[model samples]
Target chain A: MKRHLLAVSTAALLAACASAPVVEHSKMTGAEIAQIDAVLKRDFRAKGQAKMTRLEPDAVQRECNLHADNPPDSVARSLQEAQLKTIKYPSDSLLGDWKNGRKIAESGRGMQWNEKPANPGGGGCYNCHQLSPQQTSHGTLGPSLKGFGKTRGYGPDMQRYAYGKIYNAKAYSACSHMPRFGHSGSLSEQQIKDLVAYLLDPKSPVNQ
Target chain B: MLVSGRSVLLTAALTLAAGSAAAQSQFEKYQKMVAEGSPVELFELVGEGLWKKPQGPKNASLEQCDLGLGAGVLQGAYARLPRYFRDVDRVMDLETRMLHCMMTLQGRSLEEATKRLFGNADKPSEMEYLSAYVAGQSRGHAMAPGQSHPREQAAYELGRKLYFYRTGLWDFSCASCHGEEGKRIRMSELPVLYKPEAARPLIATWPAYRVSNSTFKTMQWRINNCFRQMRTPEPVFGSEVVNAMNMFLTVTAQGEPYRGPGTKR
Candidate 1:
């Protein structure tokens, strides 16, 4: 095993060196990134609920984009800390009604230009997660949250973690594929709390 | 064509179903089933008629419209698309080229041509039918998009950046969903389109007939719809960004055999 590891490391080192030129050529310059952003702004038109503001990247987004979603550990830690400060946790219990949470998870509706701005958006959880055991057509993007409560224990700490994650996934993991539901104002505080309950409540189908 | 298609599908179906050990294989079976029942040829046939029929102010058929090979020559043309057109001085994919033909050859106003660009199942668009027919002709050719031209090179670069440039309410660049391998959204396995392994098969089979919506879709419409789901502003049809993005994917899948105008679930 030791010999095999050494061999693999040597091969990897050689491969990395060999591909250095290609990597250098592929890296986008700040000016080029700006130009691409300009092209997008010019080519795309604001329609319905999707305004031109959507094109503008936040600090976390700019950093993530610059680094191709893999910023340096120190940068990521600072950004994540900033993101964590954005979450508005409820004064009371983090958990809400699990039934409502199930509905939110199953729904893939929300925030699209075609959708109504007045209507509250669905969590779209099932779009990238496996929550309930009965839902077999679940996505495999994120780690499966099946039996989340049972495995992790339905405790206050777990509930708080779930709420914070749902509200702003970037707070926990910078550049996560999951959307910042609450931070983006796509989901209400109550809705995120409901999603937390859906994940952590003992009676929830996800736990079962 | 129908008889041969049915027989081929029936044989394939018989050979399948024995390998249902995994979910991926199961999804493959479902895809196969959808592909087998697709009425893609019907759309192609309609497109052929539209291509020949005269309608605009000039009452001229698109038979004389050049698709890079020359006027009216369609064989393997789709394979070489999103190419730099000297006349337009821009990189145009199949739909953009067709739009150019509509204005230049047919004498149709841009508004009139673009008004019904995307259509529903009950009523398909001119662009959709045209895409199916034009793309079908390139079945055996290798996917070789224009890369030599400075404009083409620039477009590809822009598209590469756009693919990873995350923004919008959801903060989804194309890479957010499609970057990682083995990731899925609601049972649909997202393809990492930048990589040749995924880009080849997908690029070869675009301008596909979708079974779910019962509609013939062009690459232009496909990109536009993706932006809608991405929670971004609508991409203007046949715009530079859309063509550039298409160029990027096509260039990535370069040298892969063109095998579609395919069926999609």
Candidate 2:
């Protein structure tokens, strides 16, 4: 039945492609993206913390959208370099308490319109990446961080990498799906350092 | 087809639960139990009453309202919706068309009609009940939304682009979670909605009764909540983006038998 459904839709899509007077590529054109932007501006109203400005894509986002999230290597590298400059490294230790990190990792709340601006938001780490061996409900969207410290040695360089990655994931991968926690002000320096400890601390369950 | 349908559903369920067979089966068992005792029929009955009830300025029922079929036709009407309406000169989904009916046939103002578009467990809205009733009327009919119309084609194109168009604080698009198969967000498997196989069962059972929230949800509400989660501004109800996304999903799953207003976790 699944195969039947697949065949039917494939045939339909093919027919649609064949019958078109002008062959249009599946990639989004600039005008169409602009049209979508226009529609969003016209159709979406500001609610709670979600402002009309959220509709506007940043430079990295614009390039990602134009290239379908697979920008050219040179462009992506340059974008990554530009993004790296945005992260603010704390002058002190990169790692914070992992116990606090556990709470942040478990939480999936933050930056949503329903949330209050004054209240501290969660890292929502468990929503995408597995951390400890105990939490089986973790998501598979990101690579698992179980035994993270064990696999990658618990060095200062690793801690710095973890902190920077958590701060702005796009600094490493230009079109990454992960949010820019520090850059976007979703997670503070302390919150990011705590998350770094959650992954890299020897005593953390992630290393167990 | 019914036997095959059940198997297809099972296959999809098991595919989602690839790593944990035991947990998946237990979840499936819970789902079956929930479906058995669903209050969907109650919502449908209430909807029927609302459909027949006389209200608004004209004080006329929705019986005269045409749902892309001739006036008063109910059977199989939903299966072919989000279609282009000649009278309105737009591609409208079920809720959109129903809103048009409330204004035209019953002479209700747009503000009055859409005041409580979404409802909670304690009190489901008129739109929720009405969607259940109308969608139930198309149970066995093949899912066939509009595609031939130039506007519909444009909507589909827009929807396709929107799926991959990453924006917002999280830089998340629909593709962030749903672009890949065999991925999940905290145990809930994200369906790769662009794929026909993934979309078939998912799209077939929409405007569903959500057990977790104890609320009946429409496709429009579904899209609305997703954007909210994406940390973006709220989309106006029944807008082109919402309808266009619906168009993309429905068109992708065309020819699947309508098996909802369904039960969901």
Candidate 3:
């Protein structure tokens, strides 16, 4: 019965495509993108923290949009270099308490329009990545960081990398789907440090 | 034709074999069980009552209201909607058309009609109940949203553009999650909306009863929530931008049977 349905659908799709005069393309032209942006600007209303400025694409975002998140090596390198300059590491420590970091990772409360601007927002790390083995409800969009410090040695370099990546993920990978938590002002330097510790501290559940 | 037929059979067999090998998780099995015995009928009954009830300032019911099927005609009306309406001189989805009725026929202000469009699990809105009832009426009908009209075509184009237009904090578009085939986010398989096969089943099941939230959802609410998560500003309800997106999805999945007010995770 399922096969029959599939065959019927396949035939119908072919027929529709053949008959329809519409020109469907995967890539959008510059003018089309601009038009869409205009339409969005007109249709969307800024409610609280969600201002119209959020629609404005940054340089990295523009490149990612143009290339469909698959920019050429040279383009990616240049963009990443520019993005890397945006990250501001703390003058002192790059690691903080992992316990606080665990709470930050679990909470997906930041940057939404409904959220209060005064309250400290969460890192929302667990939304996309599997951080600790005990959390069965974590998302799988990102790579698993279980036993992160155990697998990759708990060194200063690893700590720095984690802090930098959490601070500005696009700085490392030009078109990464992960949000620039620190760059976007969604996470503070201290919060990022805590996240770094959550990933790199041997005592942290992520490393355990 | 013969080769294509044989290939289809082979593909179906492989899909079945794969499906059996990777058995459904306990959670999915439970969801399926719950879905099989859903109480959506109660919502439909409530919706039917609302449809006939007279409570607006005009002291009239929605009986005379046209759903692009002439006045008071309900059969197979939803199947051919998101189409051009001459009275409004615009293309409208079901919710938009219903809103228009509330304003014109029922003598309600735009603010009053749209003041509480979305509802929670404790109390479903009139729109949710009405959508459930209306959509249920067209259950066996084929999905045939407007595409031939110039406005509809334009809406479809805009929706297509919006689908791939990536921007914002996460640098995500609808395509970011839904553009690819055979990809999933945290065990939930994302459907490639532009592709006909993947889009058909997804579109056929809308105004769905989401088990996760214990709430019935409309296509308008679905689009609004997506933008919210996309880190973009909130879209106005019954806006052209949303209608266009709905047109795109509906037209893409045209010809699939309407089997909704469906259950969802």
Candidate number of the best DockQ: 2
Query: In model 2, what is the error at residue B198, expressed in angstroms?
Result: 0.7
Candidate 1 residue pairs in backbone clash = none
True contacts kept of each: 0.65, 0.69, 0.51
Candidate 1 docks with a DockQ of 0.33
Stretches off by above 4 angstroms in model 3 are: A1-25, B1-23
Model 2 CA deviation exceeding 4 Å by range: A1-26, B1-19
Q: Could you tell me which 10 consecutive residues in candidate 1 chain B have the lowest summed lDDT?
A: B12-21
Candidate with maximal TM-score: 2
Docking class of 3: acceptable
Candidate 2, lDDT over the whole model: 0.86
Local accuracy of candidate 1 as per-residue lDDT tens digits, B2-82: 345444544544444331247567557767777877889999999999999997999999999899999989988999888
Evaluate all candidate structures by whole-model CA lDDT and list the values in order.
0.85, 0.86, 0.81
Q: What is each candidate's DockQ, to 2 decimals?
A: 0.33, 0.46, 0.34
The predicted structure with the larger DockQ, 2 or 3, is: 2
- Candidate 1 chain A worst ten-residue window by lDDT: A16-25
True contacts kept of 2: 0.69
Q: Give residue A185's lDDT in candidate 1 (0 to 100).
A: 89
What C-alpha lDDT does candidate 3 achieve relative to the native structure?
0.81
> Best lDDT goes to which candidate?
2
